[model samples]
Target: MELSLLFEISMLLTSACAVLLAGWLLWQGQRQRAMPALAGFAAMMALWCAGHIAIVQQWPVLGIALVLANPLMPMFFLHFAVQFVADGSKPLPAWLQRGKLLPVLYGVTGSIILLSWLGGGGKVISSSGFSAFFVFQGIGWLNLLYTVLLGIAAHLILWQGWRIHSGNKRRSIVAMFLAGGWGLLLATSFVFPSLGLNWYPYPMLLLPSYLLLLVYGVVRYQVLAINAFANKALLWLGMLLLVLALMALVSALLGQLGMQALSAVPASQLWLYSALLLLLSAACYQPLSQLARRLIYPGGQLDESLLAHWRAELQQAQSWQELALRAGNLLSARLRREVSVQLPAAGDTATGLHILCRRDSSGWQYQLTGWDDVTPGYRLQGEVFAALLLSSCRILEQSLKLADAERKRLDQQHLVELGALSAAMAHELRNPLNIIAMAAATTPAETRGHIQQQLKRADRLIADLLSYSGQLQLQCSRLPLKPLLQTILSQQDWQGVQCQLKVPDGLTLYADSYRVQQVLINLTDNALAFCRNQAQAQICIETQHDNGDILLYVHNNGPAIMPQQHNSLFQPFVSKRAGGSGLGLAIVRRIMQAHGGDVCHRTDLGWPVSFELKFKQQPSALSTQIQDNIND
Candidate 1:
């Protein structure tokens, strides 16, 4: 093919690739305003490439129009780079921010160039005539001047972006620089010929490679979205293209060899030679394609090795801390930096050399430091390592949660066994105690009274144990709160202390009636005891509805519990009263919990000392039946 035709074909291919890349970028949702500018840049470059092809093909009018519009491409690139580097919150430099002037200039110059060409004032006299001082020369010099100026400005903006950006963003900017620089180098073919130098446009054939690099940046670094698989797809596509190209090359070589052999042999043997060449080409295609793929895509093996090693290390990690340490060591070796890993402090910053990876679900924060030597590729490695560290941390956390759950289950089983044994022993001792109490009744009244009191204490202890063990079956039903409170108050001795009931009428509770009664009796007894030493002793039982639940409060005009003792007060064997078995409140708490409610001491309430019981208000079949019976 003629060199000019080859250049045209190359330019056409580059234009198509550029347009496709521009379309893909613009179609993405996460591409901010900078991405649209980038898309515009790509589209304008494609148009410029098409203009070159048109010029080479002798379409002067169409070529001039496209060439006149070429300045817009670099301007668009500069605009994009400026925006890409700028932090949104900060204003850009006044000159850099004013992008409207470039388009205005392009419009004015483009019109001038078109008018000059139409007026027969501009014509190419020699290859160097574009820059030569010819009186009737077109606006070629002006176009060249503007192109150079815009290209310089675009590079400067890119450099600024590279300086300002960090981490993966800086890497993307570097990729853009390399790609754009390579395209500009190839573009020098036009410059050399314009300067009247003898040069082939073969360099321009590599223009499509520039677009590929930009596409690689978009995919590999995830300029749009952080997708690791996009890079994998790009790598696979590259490998496939390499294989196809090698197959074509092999076929071309075989065809050349067959033509030479046929030229040396007789015409009758031409068909035989062609068939043998065809077979040979086919035989070589796969092996050549495989060889090319191996040479061109050798990084796949290295990546796989790295991934496997990291995955194994991650699996062996015992905790988040261990994962961080191991990951830091791996990163240090890979990146050639002194790396330290630790949990992030409250005020730790993630700027500069620090890379912070946080997993809120696991409450883990990995701070990777000493990244001063980090390059773009090393930054990517750090990101992958951080991800691996996070995965390991999540696995470790889940394992710990499972282990803790298992431990709790085993402890509960042991508690059940111990409770069953205690209950059996208590039942066996109860009969003997009853007989002893009866026998003691034949003695003096005081001794008999003491023996009966001791027996009652033992019985209460056994009942408390049963409640804690969850052995007491609940018969939950709806009951009027007012009636229950009144019955309990009527049965209590009061001991000169005033008792008040503020339970609302018609208010109902769904709970085991017997267990609820037992809970209330325990609260009232404790309240009465605490209030006994008060100047104006009083106790109050009240109920209120809150958040789809019933809240019952037993209040006493007594000293408040100390803040330090609040948590342990509900635990078994913990009490503030003298000679108290300390099981009353514990049993009350356990019974309330078994009813799907909870008991808690409330110092912040209507009285100084109070205990609140919260119960869910959902109606059950038994509750509904009891309500109907009450109504009837």
Candidate 2:
């Protein structure tokens, strides 16, 4: 009668646990990534009951069911470990993958365990000390190895959980698995055998539920999303569960002692006993850690603190290096995760990437104790900081663009005013230039030598005036630089003084060719006239095109402009010679400007007087001007 009653009570407790497990696992199947695995755990429990019925009826079919059930323990755990720490990836890899081997190994191991069970190596013993009963397994030391393997697998699952990235919600799930697996393994190994060997059954059957959250992570969003990690909901749930479990343990102890005293009470009073325990468990939760504070902090002292910090971030110069460091700090501190961002080489083509973090490699920043970068050997877990990472990238780009735009706007305004002043000054000087030309024309044959000198000077002045007033706009048609230089020199008969124009072939400039040629002509003319001493004077014009700037240098072994006047070279009416309108180089500078080019004095006094004119280049540097007319 005692043995049968014990079996009957054990069956009731197992049945109740099976029902709860089934309901929870089934509900969770729809939510998490490893629902199929959790359901497998539920089926294992439900089928476990059938093994007893099959044994009672002497049915042979229960043999298969019993054998298959053992593997479910590992299968569920392996699946949860994958899900809990986000190790599992879809389209699971073949033979090489940890995922593929898990289920496959379960099948092989289950067969071995089953063969052992049926071969008389294992027996189930029923125990009854109080109103509750449980079946204890007596197996050889080999069976003890089974417990050891389970313990090891549980440790792995727990380790995987704890290693999850810092900013992810999956960490909570991992923490739960860690706690439960530890509890289950310790209970079976030490707790059950102590104090007259009371086997209350696996108390931490909710590991599968946490795995459900991982499944949810896959469908809705990653489990380790920053927002999910920051959320305190699951943490509260875990605390509540811990409190309830402790209350039940305490209540069961006190209730059992009371039952010993009150022998008149029915054994079925265990239902009322369990109920009271659950209620007390619900009440024994950790103190609510300031619900009002969490809500009001955004608008209160915390808000003030955050605003001050955000303002400081704004004040920091938006250099890529500074922004990167700031982002790294936030990711490290807020998520409690370590991360490193690497920049691609100047020529790399990749747009984006997300790599897993691990422990064996130098994966993350130094602050994290165990975590490292991902590799085949190391697995990554925790939260995915994808959104935050992407956000930082965009913010950096925007800040750079804003700074560049502000600088360009200020520069453009100055250029526009300078252009206006040039136009006004050209208008003011035109009439005076014509009067000087008339005076020089009228001085004529009466004083021929002086008249000729004055006439020649007046002619040069008129050319400068015209060049200044041109206000040339860049035509911007693509043309070769060599042909343009040749054409400008061709207009000048450099007979007495030989000229050598050396320019890279196929170099093109995007500018008004007319204005660019006009500047070159004025520069070459000035260079040739200054070659005073030598009978065979030499003038060489060299062109260098780089970084979209065309640098044309007109050189002559002539007197150089004074160092003090270099800044004033392009200004109107500034000259190195007397009776000079001081406008030849000035006119060249203005024409270069109209073509979006600039002319600068290349070197210091008495050195080869070189005038450099620069212009922006077009798409291709290919020379395509028809008919090479520089045969002269």
Candidate 3:
């Protein structure tokens, strides 16, 4: 066959690929704003390649379509480049923003070219020297100039984006930049044939190389987020195409070599040769596909050793939380994307490229998100990941069961210890405290008061120990917030202190009133102690709504808690303040937990120190009782 015929075949194949890519991009464009421009670019590329095919077949109308599409192609590319790198925090440069008019101008130019062609003012002449190509004459040269300039401007915009961005965005920009640059540089050769240079458009032979670069960008950098299912289908299609092409080439070579026996074979025996070729293709498919994938995505394959290591690590996990964290981290590191392993909760169905995992009986769900790219081989890797996760989740369930059993055993042991400790405190310590109180009655007024204070402190210490050890049974009720805060403040010796209550008069909380009072007393007492020495000692009780929950804050203008102590601040027997029982915050935490709430020390509220109590907003029958009382 002639080389010209081969180039024509190549152009047809390139056009087919370009059209397919354009459709794929358009489908992707429905979900992503950046894809329409890219889709348009691919459509123009298809038209341009089709024009070459048309010119070879001596079809003049479709041949002219190529020239009209030429300038418009790069304009689409330029628009895509601008949209691709657009970040809300960064505005487009003034000059580039003004350059938006270029597309409109090019669109008008394309229209003019089409109108002129229809009016017979312009013509496409097939090159007599190169049978596979064509040249433009008259106003057609204007379109070529427009194409060259637009191509350069598109590349410049991509270059700017590549320079301005970093990380994955930068890498994506680099992919587009390099691909467009190669396409522009090689594509420029097509203009030479029309320049009266007898040079064949050899660059057209490498036209598919530009598409390959774009594919690399799409696969490697995730320039476009193709679906995994689509990726799998494409991979299969590609392999099938490869097999067919190889078979055709082999048949053509056999014909060229003039194999007498093979050529002289009867038509009835052709099925045997076809069957042999089919068998050969089948035998070669797996290895060839694997080899191609290995070359394309080197890190995608899961090694046996790595799988074994992951299994061992998952099985050995001490707790369910640690197991989830380890699994998520391992997947994130392997996939180079974010992965989250969590207990499935109410609200959203798993979001953003997530897989619902129902691997184990316990039904723990994990999501793999942040899928910026889907390469050819990732479907196989994704299957492997799912299998690994399924097996790992069973291990996670076992670990959680074991942890629960251990906790039950420890709780029984703790109850036994509490019983013995309580006995010791009542027998050994309470007798002496009672004696001190009795002796205080015989002492002078000032001396008696000092002795009474010491007795009360010792009694309170014993009570706190018992409270911390024993499980609480709550009697929840609707308590008015402002009045509750007022009663607690009245008990405080904050005569000269600036005590502010920011609680709404009608605000109410559904909790055990006694426990709520105890929590407030502990928090307020701590705040008062901390800020007592400050020049303008102040304490503020504030409430804010948070996602149906109420946040109560007790903040003070006191010396900040040391950063080093923040970690263990809520632990029992841990205190920085002198003369503290070291059980106040720990007791407060216990009470909050019993109410299905939580308390934490915070420093972000413009106060030196603050303790926030989050009251979970659970609906209750008594919720409207306080409001009724206020109305009355």
- Number of the top TM-score candidate: 3
Kindly report which residue stretches of model 3 are placed more than 4 angstroms away from their true locations once superposed. Answer: 1-310, 313-375, 386-394, 397-412, 619-632
Tell me the alpha-carbon RMSD of every candidate. 24.1, 20.9, 22.3
Rank by lDDT (best first): 3, 1, 2
Q: Write the per-residue lDDT of candidate 2 for residues 1-632, one digit (tens) a residue.
A: 24434443444445454556456556644556665564555555446554544443445345334633554555565665556455443222243245566667667567656655655443344333223222334333344456457647755654645554454444455545555554455336222522356554433233334333433333233323424533644665566566556555654676567855544444345444654565565455333334444443322222356545643553363665565455445544533445443322212222122222212344222122233433311122212233333444455567777878887677456545655665576566666766765666665566656756665676566556655544344445777889877777778866578887688888776765676666676677667666745666888877776686777777788765667877887777776655667777766765555454566777753345777677755435323332111110
Name the better of 1 and 3 by TM-score: 3
> Could you tell me the TM-score of candidate 1?
0.42
lDDT (C-alpha) at residue 386 in model 1: 72
TM-scores, all candidates, are: 0.42, 0.34, 0.46
Note the clash tally of each candidate. Answer: 1, 12, 0
lDDT of each: 0.69, 0.52, 0.72
Question: In model 3, how large is the Cα lDDT of residue 318?
Answer: 65
Scored by lDDT, the top model is 3
Worst 10 residues of 2 by lDDT: 623-632
Could you tell me which 10 consecutive residues in candidate 1 have the lowest summed lDDT? 623-632
